[model samples]
Each structure stands twice: as C-alpha cells, then as structure tokens.
Target: MSNLSATSTAQNSSTPIVLTIAGSDSGGGAGIQADIKAISATGGYACSVITVITAQNTLGVSAIFPIPLEHIEKQLDAVFSDLNVVAVKVGMLADCDIIKLVAAKIRQYRPAFLVVDPVMIATSGDLLLKAYSISTLKSELLPLADLITPNLPEAAELISSDVPTNKEGMEKMIGKLRKLKFNALLLKGGHLIDDENSNDLLILPNHVEQLNAIRINTLNTHGTGCTLSSAIASYLAQGNDLLRAVQLGKDYISQAIAHADELDVGQGHGPVNHFFVGHANVR
Candidate 1:
C-alpha cells in the first residue's frame, strides 16, 4: 500500500484546504462543482483538479472528454505544490491511465486523508469509468485510499458479484469485501429502494459499523454520492475522525435530499440544495 500517513505541514491557517480530483459537470450539479459547494458549505477551502469534462445536466451525461494525461499531471502539481491540502476526494477517473497517474501522485504527496468514491456510473445510468479500468482502479488506486465509498453497483463491480437487493444480501458480501486491499469501506445502501431507511455499512479492519437514516423520498437525487463523499472529505480536512466525518456527511446529505424539492433545476433528476440551511455553517 502507498504511504497512508499524511506528510507533516505547518498548521497556521484556520480554514483547512480540501482538494477534489474529479471530473467536471457542466450542469453545475455534480463532480467538481458539487465538491466545491460541499467543501465550502462544510467549512473547508475547496480546490480541484478536473480529470474529465462532461456535457452533463440533471437529465444525463451526453458526452465525455478526458483531460490529457500531461495536463492532468500539471493540475495535480499545481494544487499540491501550492496549497496545504489536508484531504482529497477522488471521483470519476475516466480510464486506466488517469487512475494510475492519480495513484502515483497520491503516493508522492501523501495527503492526510484520501476518500475514494468509486464512481463507475452516474445516477442517470451513464457509464463514467471505463469497463476495463475497473481492475486498474482496484489494483492501483483503491488500496491507497483511507476510505472508499462504493454504492451497491460500485461494490458489486469491484468484487465481481451481484448487486445486493436487501440487507441480507449486503451482509453476505462483507466477507468478500474484506478480502480487498483497503483500509476502510463505506458500503452505501441507498440503492435498496424497498427499505424505508437508508443504511450504510462502514467496514473497518477490526470492526463494522452500520449508519442508518430515514429515507427521504425525492426525484431530485442527482449528485448525492459526490455531495456525501465531498462532505466527508471536508470534515476530515477540518480534523474530524473517520467515523465522525462519515456521520456528519450522512447528516448533511440527508438534509440536502430532504430539502431537494426546493430547487427546480432540470427536467429529470435535480440537485440537492447544498446551501439548504442558508448561509449558516452546515456543521
């Protein structure tokens, strides 16, 4: 595993810097846009290194253009060289090369916390990561993550198993997931549509935790994964422990989803209100 330990840095600034290395959503709902909103909303300074650019909106992803590998490296260098980045949230890496490049940079910089959101498919059912890149992601990138947030489909893809439809099915996959080389796993159970409550499993090396919240019924669920992971990264950057950060992130996302109806964005799945509580700190 790449060095999971954070490199020492001066603690002079009050606002913690959080960097997000992900794709860009032109719709301004998910990807880099959502990460920035979530980080700032949760009281962290946000920075980004966009890996891919998508012509996307609430409806769906129309087209994708991966940034050149050289430019991607330049973006990583620009952020890590200047900012005192405390945590990183990775999402929507387009291919094997991008994934490998990102893993190399993380090894070199060794940020304090690494949150990997294995974004294989968008909420609209559009494929994000290439089918062949799954193996590269699991082998080269995931093992380096401090925490990997994978939903049902993503988890199934990582393990080459069937997607779980219920709590029992989710539990059965625990042993399979434990075999993977990663520090911690947050198995998001939001895909269980039949359940009235949303429950997520946090699988640590020594312990397993189940986080539960009442399901908020809404069609405006676009960018939920991106928002939650970025919120967790922001909390981690602000010095919260892993468990605390996950809990806080869950709360923020639930609220955002609950209040999602307030925004009337696109024709299909709309975005959650990142600033749902007005200008007040989301924490």
Candidate 2:
C-alpha cells in the first residue's frame, strides 16, 4: 500500500474522494464514464482506473479489449498512492485474472467503502464478463465488498437459478443473496419493470429494506446500474450509513431516468440525465 496522505489531491481535505475501477464506454453512457459522472453529480471527487475498453453505443457493444494486468495494477497503485479515496466502486472486470488482481489490491489498500457492481451482461444482451470469471467474482471479490449491487439477471447468475420477476420472488432472491456472506447487497430490481413499481432490495447483515419507485417508461435506460452503484459509493464516502446511502442513490437514479428524454443522444437505449438537477441541457 502506498502512502495516501503524501499524495492526496484534496483541495479541502474534507471533500470525499471516490474511485471507480471499471471499463471505459466509448459512448460515455456506462462503465467508468457513467461512474465518474455519477460520483461528480453526487458531490464526490471522481477518480478512475480503467479495466477494459469497449466499443459500444446505445445500440450495442461491438468489441471489448481488456487492459493488461500490469497496467491495471499500476492504475490501482497510482490512485491509492495519490488520492484520498474514501470509497471504491467497481464495475466490469473482464476476466478472473483481473478479478484476482483487484481483490488483492483492495485487501491491501482497505478503503472505507467498497461497492461492487456485478456487471455480467449489458442491457442490450451483450456479455461483459467472461463466463469462467463468475466463480472468482463470487468467492474472491465479493467478500471484500462493503456493498454489492446486482440486477435481476446478475442475482440469478450468482445463485445459479432463475431470478424471480415478481415482488415475492425478488424478496426470496434477496434472502438467497444474503447467504453468500457478503457484507451487504443492493439487489437492483430495475429489470423487473413489468409491474407498476420497480422496487430495489437492500440487504445488510442485520436487516432488509425495499426501495420502491414508480417505473419510468423510457428507452434510455443505459448505465443505470453503474450510476446507482457510483452514487451509493459517493454517499458512503460522504459518511452516510449504508441504508441511507442506498436511498439517496435510488433517488438520484429515479430523477436521472425521469429526465433522460431531455437529452437526445444515440438511437438505441440512451443514457440517463446524470446532471438533470442542475444542467438540464448541454447538447
């Protein structure tokens, strides 16, 4: 571990510093792009360590190139050595080697908050993580997480079964995830939009809570999972409790989706308006 105090870039020292370790979306909708935007919007200084680079847009992912393991290690070392990173939000890890490297680094640095978004598949049905890496993600990286955010399909994959679409099934899914021994979980119910309300399940060691929101019907649903995880990480960096952070993060995404139509980006699934509260239009 590097001496963070010697290289901290905090102008005020009091402002929270949030680090995002993920892939880069050339379209600037998801991955490290969305993570940076969400962290900044939620009042945290954003730092990034790109794990993979993807040629993707609203339509779909065309190609993905993983960053070299040595380069990835250097990036993590650079941030931990220089930044006062209070919280770390992890996104796409392309393979088992990358996952192992990340887990080792996290164990060394020991940030205050660690939020992992199990990004296996994209909204466009594109695969992000390799199939063989799933076990390493479950057994290694997840244990280090302060919070793990997984959508319906992701939760299903983790448990090796079909994810329940209904409210009752979602509840049971949360229970199953709890048995995984992770510190906490934010079981995202964003994919369960068939119902009138989209309810996310937050499971801590002690209790479970449901965060309900009226489903916003929109084609611009890209990067929502990344955004939500980053937001929670920001809030956690700012000293909010886990449940409170989850709630605030949920609120941010809700508004972001509500105002997504204001921006006319790509033709397929567009991105949520992360800056919806302040800068409404900047096309």
Best TM-score goes to which candidate?
Answer: 1
In angstroms, how far off is 113's CA in candidate 1? 0.7
lDDT for each residue of candidate 2 in 1-283, tens digit (9 for 90 to 100): 1111222333335878999999999999999999999998888889999999999999999999999999999999999999888889999999999999999999998887789999999999998999889999999899888888999999998998797878788887866787796888888887776788878888877888889999998999999999999998887777676777788899899999999999999999999999986632210
Question: Stretches of candidate 2 above 4 Å error?
Answer: 1-12, 278-283
Task: Give lDDT tens digits, candidate 1, residues 200-219.
Answer: 99999998999999999999
C-alpha lDDT values of all predictions: 0.90, 0.87
Check candidate 1 and list the clashing pairs.
Answer: none
Q: For model 1, give the 10-residue run with minimal summed lDDT.
A: 1-10
What global local distance difference test value does model 2 have? Answer: 0.87
Largest lDDT belongs to which candidate? 1
Look at candidate 1 and tell me the lDDT of residue 267: 96
Candidate 2 clashes between residue pairs 3 or more apart in a chain or in different chains:
none
lDDT, model 1, position 119: 94
